[model samples]
Target: MAEQTLKEKTAKGLFWGSINGGIQQILNVVFGIFLARLLSPGDYGLIGMLGIFMGVATVLQDSGFSTALINRKGIKHEDYNSVFWFSFSVGLICYVILFFCAPLIADFFGHPELTNLSRVLFLWFLIGSTSIAHSAMMTKKLMVKERTKIEVSAMIASGIVGVVLAYKGYAYWGIAIQTVTNAFVGAVLRWYYVKWRPTFTFALRPLKEMCSFGVKILFTSIFAQINANIFAVLLGRFYKEDQVGYYTQGNKWMNMGYTFIWGMIGNVSLPVLSEVALDVKRQRQVFRKMLRFVSFISFPAMFGLALVAPELIVIGVSDKWLPCVPVMQLLCIWGAVTPINNLYIHVLLSQGKSNIYLYNTIALGVVQLLVVVSMLSLGIYYMVLAFVVVNVLWIFIWHYFVNKYVEISILDVAKDILSFCLISLIVLCITYFVTKLIFNIYMLFIAKVLLATFLYTFVMYLSGSVTFKESFTFLLKRK
Candidate 1:
């Protein structure tokens, strides 16, 4: 009966999560098109230059306590209060430090405009920090529906604000304002939807208790951010802002593709895995099921994005953004498998093995930095290609650690995803040849999307893909 309940809860979470991701992506595409058309790559590049700083600051402000709270079996009001105050304080401090460091950042990038641009952009951390506890509460309760409402509302409000400003010639400032507005709106909505309110009372013990687990997560997140933004940092220093802009645009689209899958997997994976954490057998079962679901969705989505990069970018954002195409395609390769890596990490976290997660991520960040630095002279395309190759291959390393706790071997991991991966590749290859005769880019785009969707669906249905069948059934029932 408990297993049945979990199954239902998982389904409901996936449904809402998918809606959240889908709506958010659509809004992103809509707003992204307008802003991309209005703004230049250098405009995005200016903001992209601040990516690492903002990412690290945001990570520091949250301090991994949200995940810690979710992972805890029991929680008290004081715990949430303590986290709220702690996060609020940390956000203030990080912002202040970055505010003063802005000029140095600008100097490093040889863009004096970044001094002011970064100071304004840095405000998102402050606005976002206040909602950490509230957001964590929603995640813990699996309130994806509420979270979805909050996210979509925030995106729409911010998108309108961003588009208007961009249309008014605000340049990168439009993007920056949009970002800060999203945080502000989401924070406000989180407070509104989450009933829990923090009291003035705060305690050190709870913070200390969670910190032992959270501190590892903290460092792990830090390294993870560094790895993600290393390219931006390197490109900013060694190349032009427009070059960094191109990579940023590419990485952004790649992120949107994978984030759609990761958002759904993330909303349920940890909380559900934690529920079954004490039962090795049950945890393994849940983990594999989620793995299959992620594989079924991720492979085709990312591979298809890569296949249609040229048409999508040209039609959606115009040829001025064309330089980002190769970069996007290369990054899509890594994006295809990133959610699987995330699922493996969640398994480790659910089992209270954050130290392993930390070490592995630290190693990954180090290796990625070295790899990117080595390939710097070869230009952006090769650098991104090498980066993608390194990340995709790092799945084995993640598997090595996860196996120690979950006993999910590399072979088991490969078995779950390899078929989906191969099928997606073959289908896309066939679609490419099948649609080669079409000359109009718009028709070509439509044909590729339709033909690929039809082929992949027919294949999955014919092969009796349990994941596909279950997902389709669930949607039909929901409808």
Candidate 2:
């Protein structure tokens, strides 16, 4: 009965998580199209230059307490209260420091205009901090439905703000304000939906108790953020803003593609896996199931995006953004495997292996930084190629540590995802060839999308893919 209850919760979480990710991405693409059409790559590159700073600040503000809170058994109001105050305090500190250091950041990137941009952008750190505990509470309770409402409402409100600003010729400021607005609105809605309030009885004891676990997560997240944005930092330092913009634009689409898959897995993976942490066999079973599900969605989605990159970019944003096409295609390769890596990390975190998580992530980050730096003189494409290759290969390293806790070998891992990966590759290749002769970009884009979807579905059905069938049936039942 307990297992059945967990299964139900997991299913519901996935359902709402899907809704959240799907709607969020749709809004992202819609608003993104308008902004991309209105703004230049240099505009986006300027904002992208600060990606590392914002990413690191946000990680430091949250301090991983949200994950720690969720993983802790029998969590209390005091735990949530402690995290809330701590997060807000850290956020304020981060914002103030960044505000003062904005000039230094601008100087580092050789962009004098970044001083004001960084200051305004840093506000999101403070605004987003106020909601960490509330957001964590929703995740802990598997209130994905409520969380979905908050996120979608926030996106819609912010999207409008961003589009209007861009349409009025605000340039990069539009993107910056859009980001800050999303955080502000989401924070407000989180508090509204999550009735849990932090008490005045903030205590050091609870913070200290969760610190060991949370700190490791904090460092891990910090390293991961750095790795993710290192490219932007390097490109900004060594190349033109427009070059950085191209990479940024491409990466944005790639991120959206995989985020749709990982977002759903993320909402349920940790909490659900934490539930079965003590049962190694059961944990492995659950982990493998999620692995299959992510693979089923991630491969075709990302690869298909790669297949239609030329047409999609041209049709969606126009020829001015065409430079990002190859970049987007390369990044899609890494995007496809990212969710599987995330699942492996969750398994380690679920079993209280924060140390392992920290060390592994730090190692990956260091190697990625070194690889990108080594390929620096070669150009952005080489840098991106190296980045993608290293990340995709790092799965084995993750699997190595995950095996310690879950007893699932690399072969077991491959068995779950490899076929899906190969099938997606073959199907997309065929779709590309079939659609290659179409001269009209619009027609080619539509043809590639439709044909790929049909072929992938037909193959999944023919091959008796349980993940495919289960997902289809689940959506049908929900509808």
Candidate 3:
């Protein structure tokens, strides 16, 4: 296959990619409401505790081959078949290992219930392995439009199914069903849109090539997963089960913000940047565009969320999550900077410059744990402060690495950052004043969101940033 232009991939990928993800987010928000009503915070906490290993294992499943397959020019069918077989095998092995190791894992956390939960969730790997390659094929072919359609449908189906089961008193089965069905349905649907299929034929040579790069990627991914999940682990150990659940749910909401914001960047930027894998100059331009794109949206979203954290928790998750309000407030910092930080991280990885990014992430992960430990050592209020500070460190550390390699220019990033800050400041101030009239939590929050959105769009228009009218209409009109 001939290499496509970066603009073509970026235009197609980011636009439809964001739509696919945006559709998923809308469904999740609705589903979250239902699930919160169905299950208590302790249930979610139980799962979160068990999920630390599963999360790390999920990251390891990628084996970096997805990046390799996407970035390497002229990848062949044979190479993919080999990669697919490798993933299929590793996934099976992972499930088996985790199945037996479940009790030990739960023991490590000193939670007996987690044993069964971990074992039950490990079954997802078996399901995941059965459909490993088709999704990769879809991405390789740049089928973003079709991909999004299936993804949206799958998310809707998964959410509805999970909510119904939870309503029927399935307990963690609700969570379990949603997790597995999402993989089961999405993978099956991907095969329908994708053009390639892997066969039984596999070769050691191709596996070796893929694994060589994947080893680095795999360990880096593990480090990242462990780092991200550490807080959940710590929460379970140092705090009450209810506290863990609240924090877990809080992070889930924060992930809603983080995922939607970063999902736009990741789905768009990674593949787009991969096409220009050899050209640092063009890569830098693309990176800046994404950074600014994120700032234009993420800054305001995070600011507004923080402004209404209390109400959001109270109403969004119901009173079961009141304990999470503080954690939600703290993690909002991570949410706001998520786009830029993630773009730079993806930029580094797409270029195979994982070591530096890995270093920063690992160092920060350690720092994060230390901060959490220190804060927990002192008290809960200080722990929240530690959480926020760790995220701040994450932002600067990523920016520093991005500056070192991408060379997109610090001033360029600062300009985007400064503008977003100013925009958020003005809009937040307006929201505060308007709340005097619309004092109800829901109404004031809505007022703030709508007003701030209009103001941000207006400022973006004045700055000649990507405007709605110019948003690649091909995505919407392709029917």
Candidate 4:
């Protein structure tokens, strides 16, 4: 019964989180469509170059304290207070370090402008630190419903601020301003929504324990970011900023394909799984349900997007951005594999298995870092191809890890994947014929997407992936 309650709560949280994340993602898509038109790809590339340093600096600020906070049980107000101070202090330290080392960071990326760009962007860490406590506290309390709403509102507000500023020609600062404003708004709103306050004091002893766990997690975070941000780093150093912009645009839309799925899984699943850590039967039920929900939608979206990447980018972004088309397709395929991989991370954390996660992450991170570095010699096309290869490896490693924890069969995973790919094929066929008949890139893109979406949903309904009555009833009342 307690397990069931946790599932229901998780569902509620995911429903709300998805709504919030969905709105925010849509705004991002809208902005990318607009910003891609307004700014040169070189503009995006410059920011992308600095982003590598920024990513490392930001990770240093939190170092897994937040993740450790979530995994640690029975945390008190004092613990929270200590965490707040520790994270804040780390932010200050990181800011100082980044400020001092800005020139070196610029040198690493081989771009002189990266120094000032990085120094200005380093302020984000400070801004980000303010809200870590509030945000983590929300996760600790499984307050996803409130978390989602506040974040969504901040997202919309930030998008508005960014677009207006970009149009005014602040260049990269336009993007930076939006980021800073979004953090400020999100922190204020998250605190307002949660109403938890901390005096900025640290308990020397408990702070040590929190830092111990957090430091390990911090390494994990850095490893993960290194792999994810490599493209931007490599693009900036080797390719033109315009090319970086193309990649950025491609990456943006590719990520959009996963937002709702991520919403339902990562945002909601951890707290849900954590709440019932001891109950294997119930944990499995919740995990499976979450997996099913994510897979159904995410699978088809990425598949269809891959087929139409060329058309989608050409229409949404100008001809200048068309270089992203193939990279987009490669990344869209990468996107499809994430739902299952992400589920493993959440389940591991919930079961007090973060050490396993840390180990797996380290191994994978080393491999990816080397892989990405090796590919830098091969140019951007193969660099994108490296992503596809790494994704395949990731799926294998995750399954290898999960084998001990759950009984998920290879066949089961394959069945879900194959079905999704098949549906994608059906959609592609429809789009191909319709595209041939119509011949307008705009219509082909939109028509293919809509037709794919409709056909996938229809086929899923007919195949009992979900039922009409069940889905409608589920939607009608948020059951």
Query: Candidate 1: misplaced stretches above 4 Å?
Result: none
Winner of 2 and 3 under lDDT: 2
Candidate ranking (lDDT, best to worst): 1, 2, 4, 3
Compared with the true structure, model 1 gives a TM-score of: 0.99
Local error of candidate 3 at 199, Å? 1.7
The digit string of per-residue lDDT tens for model 4 on 1-479 reads: 76467657775776677677777677777877777787787777777776666777778777777777787888887777877777788888888988989888777767787788777777877888877877888887778778777877777888788888889998877777777777778878977887778875657776677776677677877878887888887777777777788788788788887775686557667777777677777676666666666666676777777877888777777787788788888887778778778887888777666677788888887777787778887877788897778876788778766666766667766665567667767766776676678677787778877877787777777777642344456678964
CA lDDT of each prediction against the hidden true structure: 0.93, 0.92, 0.75, 0.75
lDDT of 4 at 475: 72
Better of 1 and 3 by lDDT: 1
Q: How much does candidate 3 score in TM-score?
A: 0.92
lDDT of 2 by residue, 1-479 (tens): 99999988999999999999999999989998999999999999999999999999999988989999999888888999999999999999999999999999889989999999999988988999999999888888899999889989999999999999999999999999999999999999998988888878788888899999999999999999999899899899999999999999999998888888888879899999999999999999999999999999999999999989988898889999999999999999999999999999899999999999999999999899899899999999999999999999999998989998799988888899999999999999999888889999889988999999999999999999999999999999998
- Inter-residue clash pairs, candidate 2: none
**Candidate 2 whole-model C-alpha lDDT, 0 to 1:** 0.92
Give candidate 3 misplaced runs (Cα > 4 Å).
1-5, 379-381, 463-479
Clashes of 2: 0
lDDT of 3 by residue, 319-374 (tens): 76787877887787778876677787778777777667657777877787787787
**Where does candidate 4 have its weakest 10-residue lDDT segment?**
465-474
